[model samples]
Target chain A: MSEMKWGWPVIGAALFLLSAFIPLIADGYWMSIAVTIAMYTALATSWALFSGPTHYISLASGAFFGIGGYLVATAMSDYDLSFWLMLVVAPLVSALVAALIGFATLRLSGVYFVIFTLGLAEMIRNLVSWVQNNFLGSRGLYVLTDFTEAHIYWMLLVVCLVIFVFGWWLSRSRLGFALKIIGNDEEVAKHVGINTALAKVLVFTTTGFFGALVGVIIAPRYSYIEPNQVFSPELSFMVVIMALLGGAHRLWGPLVGVIPFALVWETITIAFPNSTTFFLGLAFLFIVYFIPHGFAGLIEKHWLRLRS
Target chain B: MDILVSGFLLAGTYALIAMGLNLQYGVARIMNLANGEMIVLGALAAFWAFTSYQISPLLTLFLAAPLSFIGNWLIYKFLLRPLVKRAKNQGQLEVDSILATFGISFALVGIMVSIHGEYFTYSFLANPIEVLGSTVAENRLVAFFIALAIGLVLYLWLNHTRAGTSVRAVAVNADSARLVGINVDKVSALTFALGGAIATVGGVLISTFITLDASIGVIFTMKALIIVIMGGVGDIRGAIIAALILGIVETGVATLVDPGLTLVAAYFIFLLVLLFRPQGLFGRRST
Candidate 1:
């Protein structure tokens, strides 16, 4: 193991501890912001697993997240399933759905892939809204549980840590290398006997799993899951922004990207409540243009230069 | 019969929208993700001009189209050109174009939401004309004619004109076109400008019939993309035919099924087309 690689886990552990203790030191409003940042980090990291490695942009992360939230709500409310079971089942179902989508659409590349996923997401969102309105008789599902904010926070922290470690491992593993090779050149990877299609499908499905997992965690925290709020295009846009801002392929990039993004979002929404979308949109554009590597990329480059 | 006629008209509108995107994507090979935002800009500009100045809808197109063309040209020259240069340097024009265009799209949406509040705005210059014992809005009829005229003009220009041949040559292969003494960059810029102009006209037409909101362009963009895909990329004739078919299908479904499900259905069809014929109905397979 390289000494430089050790820094990631060290930083991650420190961040986990800092995030857990932040609520204790901060007030309710600040805690709420922290929670939001943590949520985005989880979601963005989940997205990075697919987009960063395989370079297959799945614009349906928000859809999977929404599906997970809805599944948990339904399981708890209608089926009386335990919270733990909901967590496991929700992501599993999302992964299965993502696999189906991947099987159909992942063959296309670049803009075509983006367009197909965007269409699929819209279709799923419409379907969900239709079901919620017609059958559920509610625009959103609400959770009625004895769970406290602290319990939810702790649950999020554990999940985030597990996801981070998994992401770290994936980035270092042979599968990770195969994904990178495919991203760089599929023909060459295939020439060398890598099953490019299977690798892409696996990454796509796994990313959906984590996205849904984050959704399950966040739904209980908010205690509500609405089709519009959960399956928003804006949410998908924000996750892509987060991953891009942090450096798409970097582990811990999402964490680094999410903290600043969430903070800016919170601050902007507080100050310009009505016009926050405009600012966020502008910020996304600015980051994409000027800071292509995002905040994490900037830090990594500068830090490496300084160290060297 | 009404569904058929209306569908054809609606498809004409979609063709206008997809024409610009087709030029940008098919001919220029630029993966412009921000195509939808440009349509929004056009629609908003026309709407604002009509609301604020009470300009005639016809006159508004004259004003809006030029402005959108100039604005998009400037964006390509200043913002997108640099990225294209970088892509050339890296030997990966397609990937870089996708990233740059994605950024531009996000920025455009932001600027739009900032300038035009999220509320839906209706076009003020409204007049209807009767045709075949059916009431067709004058603006819709005018928009349709303008779109048809533009499409015809583009086809004629591309097929019969010297500059059009040069643009097609460049689309076929930039390096070879350059070797043959064609000014590839100029052709690309012109094609991009043409696309911008077409989208602007589409924006004006669409706003006349539907409510104009900050987000409406995205839906239009999606529809245009679907049309382009269905029509087969790079085949202008196919795009035209496919646009009409899609418009009729969408309108018929909206008439028969839930209006909201219309887009879902259209998207479902797009997936089916992609699965069965990935190159699109008329698109050539990429070599």
Candidate 2:
């Protein structure tokens, strides 16, 4: 029993630490895959942080991510700001935007909330396109940052670490309990003296912050950033699906869901090119039918039954 | 004045899609995000049938609509029914259904794209017709009348027909309707069929007005959803009115402002409506 308590976590920590050094041994090709895994892990975890706990099903990650990319792009192009400065500014701006919208949106639940989030992302996409056409005078911004894949890999590693640590602590905190209660029943949460609305808005803002932070970090790693590319609903769908596939109810579920799927995605795109989205879509259908509870859910379902 | 006239004329075409979405979501509670793809089936079928066998797009409806109707019905009967049965409650059902439909969108959209090739597009030929001093594409006029005819028929059927009334009863309260001996399964399937048919017609009509490819499904679905939300979920009249307003807003922006700003205006209206009046313009005030 004691070994099960300490040994598993110890093994997990050792594995994560060992992965941190892979960038050293891994060539550029493998490093790219590592970076993708880390990015999706961070995104899926951030998605689970709000949607898993509150059951909101947000499609706003693409919006926040696009905003972050554009924000960094504009800051670097127009003002000659450093990537580091943009990093700090990105999450704050995204947080502010989220807080502004979350005020009204927090009132909605179920499918309406889902539509609102998706609509918000589309709205932002359109707004960015309009800005690009009028102000930027170009469809996309090119940033000539001299950062290597290794640098971005480390940045992604740190981002994933921060997100997971926060989620771990949140799962144990008073607010975590409050969030769970809210997800199960909002009316009960309110009756139990929780500030349901405030909790939702605050956590939702944090989710937006981290989602946008992915954009800020990834923008310089690429050659150019485009509004349509960054603000794609496909990105939002991937993050949400990844989180659910991993089992959104737990902190580690996203990591579990993202790693294998990210590798599979990379391989398929490399092998088949345009057929990846089709494969991904097929994958989604399979998940909903056979394993609606996700990887974690599958384990939990059997584990409890076995013990009983 | 020309832009206004054209915008409203375009609105006439969009009314069917919005109404279909309203029926699916408002009455059936199925949040079919593939509403866009539902129409695409018709568009692709019509296009394929027309190019392959010397038939007009209008006449292709005989081939396109029934196929889409059956496809959607199977989706409800086989895929959705079991999931709804196994779910804990409505909230869980909504979430699960969205994910499932999203999966369907991807799977089906992928298939459509692969078959037609993603970049393939075709246009219906039509001359310009002057309407209220504005010259519009002759196909657009044809599309407007087709859409209007469907909307009128739907409104009358929903208000007067037995199947429509049964659907309304099921929409109002499934348990009560079931207790009253309404065939819940039949009504649900019928609603899905109607929803599918109207959206297919919407797709068939819209394809004539612009160049269309497989990927246009999401755009149409998104438009119908926003309009459905705007119109108040269950109200047919509201869907019609909202569709017109959205059409006017979209085309008006495209004509009067920068073409790039058209989508921006529609989304802005969508967000404003979501924030202020989620019950929508014509929906009964939600408690």
Candidate 3:
């Protein structure tokens, strides 16, 4: 058990060490791709941490992620606050909002929760757009920063590592066990004396924090943060797809989904720019129909067959 | 007075769209995220027929409904059936169906964008007529009357027809429906197809006044979902009332406040309903 506990992290650490040097050797385009992969990896991973176990499938990642970007943009552009301060404040605010949303909708049936989350994201986007148009007198905010692409990449890598480590720790924690039980049978979990709502909210709050933090780190890449662009429902969908494709059930699953999807998406974007949405739609269909359990499930199945 | 008349006109069109969703989600138990795409496609077909061949939208409606009915029937048979069959539980089915339809919506949008690549609008009955001292567009009046006629027919059919009773039975309980010799799967598939056809019909009507693009499907989907939820899920009368309320609120907001805030107002009302009356305005709370 001890060996198993240490083995995964050691391999994870080695992989992290190897990935840390990509900026030094890769070309500009490749570095940008890596940044994209890293950003999605972080987003998908954090997203899976909640949706995976609870099976609630919150589509509000856009709201949280956009909040992060909007905060950093508003603070740096309007208030002239330091980026460092945003790093602290943005995620905290995201957690608060997520907790509110979680409490409000988590008790409902799964369908209502999904719909509410989707609506909430759209509502926030509309609200932001309205505010920008009416009061700000601009459609977007410029988030100019001295940080380079490599710096952003490195920060995302670190965030990825932190999330992975936290996820690893969480898997062995009491809350994790409670979450697993709730995911399996909420009524049973309630009878077993677990505060199911609290457990779900805590995990959701953490996911929101990570989602926002990624938005904060990635905001500089966009330079100009528009409400429509940053608060996009597409981002929320992509995060959900990537995570589900990788198998949200496992901690390391989203990474597995992120790498291939990000690469394929990059190719498709360049090759058939017009048909990207078409292909994206196809991707969702294929994943849901064929690989609903994700690659991780397939691997586990294969492993079990071999052993048997 | 103007608001009431215009609101009623708007509600007349929205009723078909919302009822389509009500049938699908309320009866078939599939929360089709692609519903808006179906609407857009219907609008596209109408636009194509009207502009390319100079056929009336009324004429195009006949072609669009049967075609969409067959298309959605096929979707249910091939794509959704597998998911429905394999889903271990209701929750699993909901998740799978939502994701699949979401994908379908994207695919539909992609196909539409490739084909049309622009907004579609046409002049259909653009003349104005007086209504209770205020002038309303002739097209909107026509749309209202047609919608009212269709809605009445649908209400009667659902309440009076044997097939409609089975559909309602499936909505009420699939297991009991099956026990009573009703083919649950067939009814579900038919209901889904009917929903799609109705949405297309609504699109044909809406396209008379509103301009449509490939990407505007999600907005309509959201609106339909709001109405379906606001009204009782399976109750057609509730959906009609909800649609009317939505139309009035939207028109009032558009006229009184900013036009851009109309969606905001609809969402706000939806949120209030969700928070305060999750069962819906006319629905009895489920045990």
Candidate 4:
């Protein structure tokens, strides 16, 4: 089902490694930007993994990401756990939540599913809001990080690589095939003997795992962590936009979408911070209406036309 | 007693908003992610009219509703119609429409924010009137009555009017309606217009009670969406009941606990409903 040739994976591996060298060349500012790019790349990749295949536009990434953040923040704040321990536990925690939510939400179709996923995130955020208000006394959680920006960049890089490789592998996996078939036609997929619900849940769980894992690692960078900041709907919209803007169907599509968006995000932050969200919405409209296939597909189409 | 009356009034206002969404989603089968934008646009109209011409928001409802109606008619005719036509299947259409309307929502919100800045509040009558031994804002009572009047009018239009029959027919089966010489496209456009008009009135009502801003639309978006689903996708009566439950719950939570949890109550109900009753409280059970 992956249908990827050997050459593409080889190229992807080389390009990924080249990205790791950014910290060596760039200063701290650029290093920070690069790290953000890597984080979004990982997010977009995981998002594409689930949503691209199933066509189930998920709005719960922010919730999962926040869950990861709060989980690690609580651990550090209360239990004083090591960052390394969270490297394993955070994703697992997120996966559990995803599994629970996916069980109920996976049955929803179309717009109901989208709204529910969004509401799911909001519900979690509110739950966290309650916990923070009642138990934590409305004070923000803080974590100690001895690592420099470069270390953070490398951590993000490693996570991004793991996601990309897994995505590459999944493209060829049985589950991936099942998801694609379900995406094309759920009834047909069932008729063909695939468990559509199971495949959908797996996609949701896997994506949730990465989304939270990244949040666990990234939370230490921010000194103060609050539920509202981590669990905003805008964050969910960001990853979904990146995945959709790239050709979600392809492994590298998210990367294509992420690189440009991350760069634009950097520039826009410096130039006009408030307008970027608006612009992101405008960009979504243009891409969905004009170029639904995304940049990767646009390139493929052009190449195909030329060859023909 | 006061809480009950206040909650019922709040419920009435919510029904006005949710009913429009029902018309659009149930009858026209358009999710209209920009549904909140229509409401916001109505608020903006009222605010603008009030500021420039010294018109009362209650009086400016006429201005806001028609403008929103025309604005949504244009959106449906020009933007949504073409893209919807191009979609291959229901799934494809759903995602595309969500994205497109989302885009419109952003563009409109952005324009409003840049022009007016994010924060806004339109003040109305401050004097509290006693209603059945409970002191309530006059604006709230008026808003409740207006919402109730419109809801009744909409129900009558759907049940009695020829256009209402056509809308119901289109909702039941678009192809069948089209085959029977009902103009499905026109009904859809009219539904969007009607939805826009009613949502605008809801916005006008809320602005009377609360400080209106560009971001408030996001809150209404979540609330209306939850009410629509909790009531059953396209059932108007269900939408009203669900709206009342949510409005009461939200106000009760705000009164008893934290005001912030008002939205939290909405999310809680939405999740509980989805988990136990996916078809919604009032919707027919579907496999």
- Highest TM-score, which number? 3
Give the Cα lDDT of each candidate.
0.77, 0.82, 0.90, 0.84
Off by over 4 Å in 3: none
By summed lDDT, which 10 consecutive residues of candidate 2 chain A come out lowest?
Answer: A135-144
Please provide, for model 1 over A194-272, each residue's C-alpha lDDT reduced to its tens digit, 9 standing for 90 to 100: 9877788888888788888888877877677667777777777778877778877787777778887788777787798
As for TM-score, the candidate ahead, 1 or 2, is 2
Q: Which candidate gets the maximum DockQ versus the true structure?
A: 3
lDDT string for model 3 (A203-258, tens) is 99998899899999999999998877788788888999999999999999999999
CAPRI rating of model 1: acceptable
Off by over 4 Å in 1: A1-11, A14-18, A78-80, A134-140, B88-95, B118-138, B284-287
Ranking by DockQ: 3, 4, 2, 1
Worst 10 residues of 4 chain A by lDDT: A1-10
Docking class of 2: medium
TM-score of chain B of each: 0.92, 0.95, 0.98, 0.97
- How many angstroms is residue B67 displaced in model 1 relative to the true structure, after the best TM-score fit? 1.0
Error of 4 at A299 (Å): 1.5
Clashing pairs in 3: none
User: Residue B149, candidate 3: how far off, in angstroms?
Assistant: 1.4
Model 4, span B1-287: residue lDDT tens: 77788898899989989999888887767788888877887777777777787789889898778888898899899988887689888788888888888888888888778767755566688579999999999888888999999999989999999989999998889999999999898999999888978998898877788777785677788899999888887688888899999988988998988776787888778889888877988667875
Two-chain complex of model 4, DockQ on C-alpha atoms against the true structure:
0.64
Task: Evaluate candidate 3 and give its CAPRI docking class based on DockQ.
Answer: medium
- Give candidate 3's error at residue A225 in angstroms: 2.0
lDDT winner between 2 and 4, please give it.
4
